[model samples]
Target chain A: MAFASSRSRPDPAAAPDGPAYLPSSVRNMVKLVVAGGLGVGKTTLIRSVSETRSLHTEEVMTAPSSRVDSLAFTPRKTHTTVTMDFGRLTLGESGETVLYLFGTPGQARFRQAWLDTAYGARGALVLMDLRRPEVSYEAMDLVEESGMPYAVAVNDFPGSPVLDAATVRADLDLHPETPLLFCNALERESSIDALIGLVSHSLDVYRRNTGP
Target chain B: MSRRRDPVRITPAYLATGGRTSARRALPDVLTRLVRVDGRAAASLSPPQHHLLTAVDGGDLTLADAAGHLRLPVSAVRILAGDLLDLGLIQAVEPAELPDVELLENVLDGLRKLKKPA
Candidate 1:
């Protein structure tokens, strides 16, 4: 629910002279999902790392289009509009790659939007709040079911309980290979580290799948 | 006319797409970066189609971005963009395969640099 009101200055990378179009050298465009439960810091993390302000895009879908599990919760509504937040990061020395970070809306009724954002994504970074770990379960499950590799970051809020890492991992039922880290979503460096963890883990997963 | 029904200000998706739900060729996902190939807008093109082209005129914008600019659903943009693709008026630069090791490495390197203080 919090916006980046504290950071009033513009990003240096996105200065007035920056190129609006993708550099001709750019050949790759990757999509990464930033997901979590309601009130989690998906948007905050994206705001911290993205060169541009996070954008909200709306999708209108029929109620029946959602999976049965979601349908059961919203049977009365025939049509709905869901909005998702996204940010863009152009990386590498020559800007040969761009990463699109999509923050999924927090609600079971928006599963269709989640799937749309997850489609063709390389990996996902799932944020959790240790104070209410159970709220993140659905996001983690959706990420896993999409068959893409993912990393989990515990977004630290002030005064949040410091639970044992192993106990939290076991409660989440995370895989042995999944990368788990702690991050403060409001900090640009911390958010970037969480993204680094995800991309690194994704690289490992991709290598294992394709063989030496 | 039932008091004109609040004046139909927004263009319906069915009309914008000419009632076509799917394209003949496979459409790119919402995240796909699309660029305009032809700057000359066809006189026959609908307003929504024109808005889409203007959205991606010089810059590379994603299908979702175009939809947001056009005030239409992503589904409608997909169909409209497919029409443009079929006409060879635009190009889609599909993202590299997710499993491409080199691409992942490039992204990792970028994040590392970003982690450093600016």
Candidate 2:
């Protein structure tokens, strides 16, 4: 169980003879995953922040999946996520690179993939469509079960009821510390700002729990 | 430093699987002894090392699992894993692929039942 420490990386002060490792000024990359129910605008939000030329991830859709997959809630939707969606974005002047704007498949059948994607993520943005509020509990449960901190992003859908944050939190029975924000996923700046806020808040909470 | 020269035992399963073939083949006829430093020194590991050790001790976690558990970048996890390997505290094991769909579905169903509203 013994692991090499991150601090063991050649430190300029500790190892003068050590080769220059990471650039002094370069910011370390931080990964944040964007997750939600299907068609909850995960793609739209990533497209907003991603620089041109996002990476393409293609997975195969197998036929036998029909037997193992849960189609209860999902209508007969074609085009199984033969590919996963991911994007990269830079945050703040620190130039911290954040990879994995991962678009999770919404269907419960894809729960395995979703769990795999959740691996290694610092935190997640769980998107909820106000129109289909009940649909989000499943995603919320996954996030909670993984023991990763997550922020709820209520996407403003047309004709959707405007539920207050308190009401939403009550319905979801989330911990008070979990941040919840309203977002128009179609808007680039707003979505980014929401994510930024989530990251900051999550870091603060994590630090408090684990200490600096 | 307390040095002990324990015979390095390679398991037949490892040899049969042809895992780490190069390292196995190139291993010296006599394995170098491991020197144990003071427990106090070992207790105070760097952040990355601490995270790696925590992940490894938790179970047969993968590099990605360690990174995720520590909330560290993958590159950082990889770098730390290399160090642990050198120290002979951990060894890389091929990850088991996803279970069959039926198995996964059954597991999920079990999880769902467990989560049912009490």
Best by DockQ: 1
B1-118 per-residue lDDT for model 2 (tens digits) = 9865322212221222222212322112110111122232235555556545654553444343343334433333455555556666666532222222322232223323322333
i-RMS values of the candidates, in order? 3.7, 18.3
Cα RMSDs, all models: 5.4, 18.1
lDDT of 2 by residue, A64-129 (tens): 333236344345753244335555443333432223366665445666556655665657888888
Candidate 2 chain B, run of 10 with poorest lDDT: B26-35
Off by over 4 Å in 2: A1-27, A61-82, A92-96, B1-118
Instruction: Candidate 2: give the clashing pairs.
Output: A3-B53, A4-B49, A5-B48, A5-B49, A6-B48, A6-B49, A59-A82, A59-A83, A120-B68
DockQ in order: 0.43, 0.03
lDDT for predicted candidate 2 compared with the true structure: 0.51
- lDDT digits (tens) for residues A3-23 of candidate 1: 342254355456332223555
Best by the TM-score measure: 1
Give a tens-digit lDDT track for model 1, residues B35-75.
87865555667777776766677588777666655666677
TM-score of each: 0.85, 0.51
